[model samples]
Target: MNYDRILAARTSRIKASAIRELLKLAANPDLISLGGGLPSPESFPLDLVMELTEKVINKYGSAALQYDTTEGFTPLRKALVEYINAKGIDAGLENIYITSGSQGFLDAIGKLLITPGDYVAVEGPTYLAALQAFNAYEVHYAQMQVDKEGVIPESMEEIIQSYPVKFVYTVPTFQNPSGKTIGVQRREKIAEIILKHDVLLIEDDPYSALRYKGEELPTIKSMAPDNVIYASTFSKIFAPGLRIGFFVAPEKLGRWLVLIKQGVDLNTCTFTQALATEYLTGGYVSKQVQKNINLYRPKLETMLKELEDNFPKDFKWCEPDGGMFLWVEGPEGMDMEKVYKRAIEKGVGFVPGTFFFPNPGDGIETMRLNFTNIAEEQIKQAIKILASVVEEEMKITSIN
Candidate 1:
């Protein structure tokens, strides 16, 4: 059918996701997968879901099933006001807008702001799906340096100074792939830099509510209200299948985002939005968050302990306070992709870290491991198996 000949030029910039392909290997029931950023089935309030649905049906009636405004369902937006305000974000209904999921906002924002050859400043090893979203618009990336604290404010300033970047994107709170939280001072510095440069920043925070051991950090959005667009999802705290995510941006930008979303999907989902409205307004969030923490904290601790006991001395990983992943870095010249293949063959799977970087050839010495989805004992088994693969790779690297 030679469809390639008729396809748009922009399609060439998009590549198949390496993590998605690797997950296929993880589908084998015997494989202990530390690959996907999936929440534990136990974390879902499945018993509460039916009750919530019934409440939605009773409360909103026909409107719950009917089409809604491009912006979002009104009651859900209203309910989120008190919800986000607690996090220190001063947002009103005008500031909040919904999308199919956070992924939808990522794609819409890319479509809204990006022109071909436009540069976006991102951390060296940033969220893989973000790069995938921006790539379709043929966007270029200006890589920013990161340490254990997530994005360095100075590196961000340097990138902004060096490149004609359209915008800056960051997953500042318990960031994906890296599980590093930017501290309050760094958040202030980042806010200062963005405001000084008069640039927009996207704060992709999907994991802040899953706190395990640290004090809650202030959001970058609160630190720089006018300069940052804050986006989050119900995937972690609630359920992923609902596909309900929302953003708080300046009213002007929010309006445009809604307009842009109109062409994509008329609205996120009326019934789901109704369900979210009830969930948020019914005081279910905190209890659910605590339940998730109780379920995941031990698994995270188990994985950390297993790594300390089993992994090679030179290998290190971020001990995050709360998040779904841990970023493990092997010594220099160690390629984690080779380790991933070996681990998969041994019935353990993880994502090779290079896939997370916007630039090719970066983060080859690393991999990302997920603890929430796997049982504690399985996490123990997977880490032990994965460590052996890593040790073997280290020995091979030493010899070669």
Candidate 2:
């Protein structure tokens, strides 16, 4: 029964994600969860999906269900070319490859790039799944600085100067965990640095279209096309269960990823790709995106209002212009682990922010709250309960 000796050494680097672990608790119907960054079911275009499904089966037939080429379905790639161009990223079908999801591409990148002890420069509080994906490759990390504007170019440039990191991985637009977007001006500087250093930049943009507020910023890929690999997904916009996503890399790297994917899942789901093609070319993405924005915006506004009225004066948080989640920093010396226990006991739940960082000890006084899925009334109640727990934790910490 003992398997430790039989397991690969790389397995040691992997650990359970805190957000994923928190998801198990959030499944309890009795609890009000501000945990998972889930899209609202209200926003799902179910009628459209059913319509698309029929068209795909009738038109594509067995091709929709069969194992597709590693390069992905041609129609889907063609549609994405137009989609990315619309997003201001000029890329051809040759530059794109589909995967199971953005997470699949992350794993492929790790496989293609990382070696034992190789460094990947990442934001201090980057996407947990990326950290988890890279961990499997036994890669070490050089933490980059993240201010209110998200990953700082100056900090990333500084890291590149000293650390021999293989590449810079980022979630620049409506970044996960922090939900902070790097400004347009900063993105240009970041692109400049990447070109000068000639290092690979993985620009993840799953939440870019989820903008509920603020003006859109140019993608880092648009600025430095040849140097950056852009990762995006349909999970946020459409449905996560569909498991459709892609990455656009330079021609050479793009080829490499296709070969890499050949060994992974062969290709992303062709049926799903067919659906996504219809979703894009059929002009459903924009309409559905607007629906998502309308559905989520009020929850965000309500949560912010509740926090302002209920949270302690010194407890800090950011009002993100868009995205499913926001960051909250509690009073100094408060351990969010204990606070999570209290929150759950009060029939509420949230992700303790410590797991977002490369180091466990950092972000101890912080937590990430998701406003996308919860109802307005439940969000109000959840925030009230969470705020009380935070207040009580700080009081206990202060007293001791």
Candidate 3:
């Protein structure tokens, strides 16, 4: 019963995510949760999924249901190669390694490259799951500052110069939590710094295809191909449940990643991979992306307008061109955790920003709001309720 004594010490490094735990409360009808970065069920290409499933059954038969290589289904890998190459990255099936999801690729990188106390650099308010994945390996994280254009290149260079980092992790395009896209100049600057220092970079880019505005900026992977390990997923554009993700690394690292992957899950689901291959190759992917943009853009605009109209003048938030979240910062002395509790009591829930920071206390005055999961009407209502909660919380904090 007392398993703690027998458990590995590495387990101590892991902590349950506050947002994930809060998300469990979402099933309560009273909760209008924005805590989880989940896509709208409405956005999933359900009709296309049914069609693809039938196609897979017709084409692959029982092989679609069978065990597969750790490197993923070859057809999926080949499709991803063509996809990436089209994106202007010189990748091929040989350079691509598929995992259960992009999250798996994160874990694999953590497993392969991170030793206990290894230094990893991340954006100040980065993806909580990534921090969690790397933490299990007992890696020490250093935070780089971020601005309107995502991670500040000067801060990144400073961190790399000051520390012997194993790799610099970035969600450069439409980054999670922040929703700030790294601009072209910043991307170029980052590429130059990484090459000059010969540091490895892990570019987690699950949101690039979701762009609804602005010109597409080149991926950091394309800029410094040799030093970058690029990971992407169909989860954002297609369906999350399929859990299909791929990575492009140099041949040496790609081989090792596949080997590590084999020990973990043997391979991703064969049927799912086959389905995704069809989805991508069948010309459905682009139409689905456009559909997502059509549905989400107006909702995001609604939230932004509501925030502008309702929130206190001092409260700051980003205007992301695309992505699922908007990062908001309350007044300097305000406690976002307390505010989150108040918001939940008012039937609105959002992720407190502190959870995104590797150093917990640093982002206490911030929170992340997701606009994609809810409808336009619900978004307006939720923001109104949230504004009321913020007003009440600020009044209380002011009195205190």
Candidate 4:
């Protein structure tokens, strides 16, 4: 009955997510958690979803409940084609495919392309879930340097030059963990670099629609359509429970991903896709996104103000244009993990940033905080508690 011997060798590389475990601690009702990147429950259009449910069942009838193609629900794919085209990426029905969520594409891409020991060039402090997905495929990461503007194009090019990377991955706009968005010029440079090297890049953009301020920037995929695979999800603007995500890729890669997905889940949930199709064609996205912006913008501003007024000057954080999270970095050799532990004891929670780095012992001075899930007053209270914990930790570090 020893399952270790019967399990696949790949199981060794797939460890439980540290953040997932941390979230459990944050689940206590008294804890004010900034640990999760969860969209606000307030952001979900609950009434509209119920309304759409009736419309979908009435419109599609038994088709809504039936099995669908491995590629995806066709109407959803067609709606997404227009959705992305508005972003300036030139794509069509053939180029569109759906998955259970963006997480599904992450795993599918890793399975479709990576061989054991193959290299993947990723931003130094990248999306932690991506590392989780690729780990199962036994892929090694070649870390890229990042600045306030997100991944440096030169750093990505250097890694690509030095390694036989299967593909390059990026979350260019309002990136998770860091809340850094690459500027348009950098996006152009990244596009040029990918084209120059003839490399494939994955542009995972789930936050662009959540813009609270500033003009919308062009996607890297728009700049290099042939070279980048663009993935997005309804989790932010819509409901996460639906678990609906989709991607646009070059025809050959798209077909291969579809083939790979067939063995995983025959198809994504048809009922949810039908609801999303109506959500799109019904023109609910713009209104829902605007409502989210109105709700989150003030929380973001409140957190920034609280940080400025309460935290030590040496402790700096990213001023993101739009995103659910903020990245805070303390002075050198200052461990945020210690601060995280202390903050939790005080009924406030945030994620230590080191786990986001593919390399161990990096980003020890950093942490990520989520603003969208908590209220403005709670944000004020949580930051005050967190700032106090950080100050105490700094004093201890200084004494040591």
lDDT accuracy of residue 353 in candidate 3:
90
- Please report, as a residue range, the 10-residue window in candidate 3 with the lowest summed lDDT: 18-27
Global lDDT of each candidate:
0.91, 0.89, 0.90, 0.92
**Candidate 3 lDDT by residue in tens digits, 1-400:** 8978897889888756666676665556867777778888998877878988999999999999999888889988888888999888998778998888899999999999998999999998999889989999999998999878888999999999898899999999889989989888889999999999999999999998989898877888999999999999999989999999999999999999988988889999899999999999998888999999998899899999999999888899999999999999988788888888777777888888988898868999999999888888888899889888888888988833
List model 4 lDDT by residue over 42-63, tens digit each: 8888899889999998999999
| lDDT per residue (tens digit) for residues 1-400 in model 1 | 9978998899888756666786677777888889888999888888899999998888889999999999999999999988899999999999999899899999999999999999999987888889999999999999999998988899999999999999999998888999998999999999999999999999999999998997998998998899999999999999999999999999999999988899999999999999999999999999999999999999999999999999888888999999899999988899888888888889998899998998888999999999999899899889888888887887888834
TM-score of each: 0.98, 0.97, 0.97, 0.98
lDDT for model 3, please: 0.90
**Per-residue lDDT over 1-400 for candidate 2, one digit per residue giving the tens place of the 0 to 100 score:** 8977788888888745565665566567888888877888878888999999999999899999998898989999998998888889889989988889999999999999998899999998999889999999999899999899988888999999998989999999878898888998899999999999999999999998888877888999999999999999999889999999998889999888888889888888899999998888889888888999999999999999999999888888888888899899877788988899888889998899898999879998889999998899999999888888887887778833
Q: lDDT rank, highest first?
A: 4, 1, 3, 2
Error of 4 at 210 (Å): 0.5
Query: Against the correct fold, how does model 1 do in TM-score?
Result: 0.98
TM-score of 4: 0.98
Q: What is the total number of backbone clashes in candidate 1?
A: 0
Off by over 4 Å in 2: 16-27
